[model samples]
Target chain A: MATKRKQRMIFVIVLISGFAAATALALFAFQKNLLYFYSPSQLSEAEVTEDQLFRLGGLVVEGSVVRMPDGITTQFSLTDMQGQVQVEYTGLLPDLFREGQGIVAQGKLNASGLFVAQEVLAKHDENYMPPEVAEALKAAGGEHPVSIPKTTVE
Target chain B: MFTFLHKYASPQYFYSWSASWQKWASIIAALLMSVGLYYSLLNSPADYQQGETVRIMYVHVPAAWLSMFGYMVMASAAIVTLIWRIKVAEIMIAQCAVIGASFTALALITGMLWGKPMWGAYWVWDARLTSELVLLFLYFGVIALSGAFDDERAGARAAAILTLVGIVNIPIIHYSVEWWNTLHQGPTVSKFDSPSAHPSMLIPLLVMALAFKAYFFAVLFKRARTELLLRERNTSWVKALLKEAV
Candidate 1:
């Protein structure tokens, strides 16, 4: 009975390790596809056709927001501090949307190398503090720590 | 230690022993939950960026933590069941499935509600969200597999194997935001050295997490006791229990 139990334990370990190895390999192969969005740097490096729909994510470049004459349409530039992409969208933005905020926009590129976005999502950082604390931080010339690195492709 | 474990491993001993602790756990859970609610809802300050909606983090984060925690418990119980063939551990796997699924559902719902205003979409195919959804499905799968067989032990063994296989998803769920370009933000409180949340907000969140943990134990003990009673209905202790009730 002891030997049987030992054999069973070994069998279970082997089964689990084998299964985990297979899954790790599969996930590794699909690593690029698993990313929700591509950085501006990745977008430039990848061979993306104008008609291909994909998500572009990065910081909304400070002072790049332009509200068109039509109230709905807005244009902005996204940057990873290494590369920048111009994005235009016609939709109501989230309340969190603002210059210097990270955001992900999904759409296709146009003929003039402009990204025409169908949807845009605001991506807030991990920092959370009260308004008073934020004011103090700003007064002290400190900024909210950015958790997501600027040029992370994965 | 072995003797102590052996004594408790007996379902009859465990059934009786768990009753007193179950009462204590529920009382503690209730007390903690009240304090947690007060701190989270009224005492905590509004976030600089998210305003009042950040209060949702108290519920959402705790539920998410419990969801993962429940799975870890189930996986540990699975190991015990498979290795020692412990009847109590087998029962634990079944109980953990239902509880884990409920927590997973709660986490997903609260996350979606929080996501709508902040992220502009109620749902997204982001890595963290997607993996959590998979976890919910994995719980459902375990529950279904455990109930499929006529012999309870056989069903439990099958469920145990499945639980072990799905254990890989837990790490994926945890590190998804860091590993992939997810819309979900990275770790906040988990960062040991430099937590991103302020003390006021962090304190409430921690209190709520403790409350959830207590609640989990309360429910687990109660459910496990009932299951033990049912499973041992033909045994002498349960027969005596029934006689005493009469």
Candidate 2:
């Protein structure tokens, strides 16, 4: 009986490990496709056509937001600290959207190499603190440096 | 230790032992939840960026944590059922499935609510979100598969195998943010050494997490005890216990 139980244990372990290994190999094969969005640097190298829709994620470059005369359309530059992409979107941005904040935009590139975004979503980092604590950190010049520089103050 | 475990593994023994444990767990869970709610909703400072919307984390994160924790418990019970053919472990799988599914559903709902105002979308097909959704389906699958078989033991064995197979999704859910470029943010509380959240916020999050754990165990023990009673209805111990109750 004891030997039978041990055999069952071995069998269960082997079954689980085999399933896990198969899943791991499958995930590895489709690693690039699994990425939610491509960084500005990756977008530059990829074989993207004007007609293909894709997501671009990066920091909103400081001092790059330009509101069109119509007041609905906005143009901004997104950068991954290595490469930059010009994005134009006409919509209400999320509450967290601001200069130097990270965001993901889904859109297609136009003929002039401009990204025409249909949707813009803000992506917050892991940091969380009260307004006062943030102020204190900034005063001390020891603010938690997100990927982008803390140049714009809300 | 083995003998002790074996003794308690019996439904008759566990039924009596679990009653007082359930009572104590329920009381502690209630107390902790009250305190945790106070700290999380009132005492905790709001996020600089998210403001009051960040309060959603207290519910969302704990629910997400419990969803995974419930699966881990089910997986452990699955192993015991497979190897030892423990009757108690089999019952545990059925009981855990309903509770785990509820928590997974709660996590997903609260996440969508939080996402709309913060992430600007109600849902996204990101890796983290998608994996968590898969966990919910896995829980439902376990519950449905177990109930599908007429023979209870056979049903449990099948469910246990499925549970073991689904265990692969747990790590994927955890590391999805790091493994892929996800819209969801990375780890905050799990980092331990240098958590990004302030202590005021982190403390409340931890309190809420503990409260959820206590609540989970309380519900699990209650459900398991009731299941043990039903399963052992023909046994003499249960008859005596029922007589005593009457």
Worst 10 residues of 2 chain B by lDDT: B1-10
Model 1 segments more than 4 A misplaced: A144-150, B1-4
Model 1, range A1-154, lDDT digits (tens) per residue? Answer: 7787788788779868888898889989998899899889888787889899999999988899999999999999999888899999998999989888899999999999999999999997899989999999989998654544345653
Model 2: per-residue lDDT, tens digit, A59-90?
Answer: 99989999999988999999988889999999
The digit string of per-residue lDDT tens for model 2 on B34-79 reads 9999999988888888999999999999999999999999999999
Fraction of native contacts (fnat) of each candidate: 0.77, 0.83
lDDT of 2 at B224: 88
The TM-scores, chain A only, for the candidates as listed are: 0.94, 0.91
- Candidate 2: list runs displaced more than 4 Å: A143-154
State model 1's lDDT. 0.91
Error of 2 at B56 (Å): 0.4
> Best candidate, DockQ-wise?
1
Q: Candidate 1 on B92-166: residue-level lDDT in tens?
A: 998999999999999999999999999989999989999999999999999999999999999999999999999
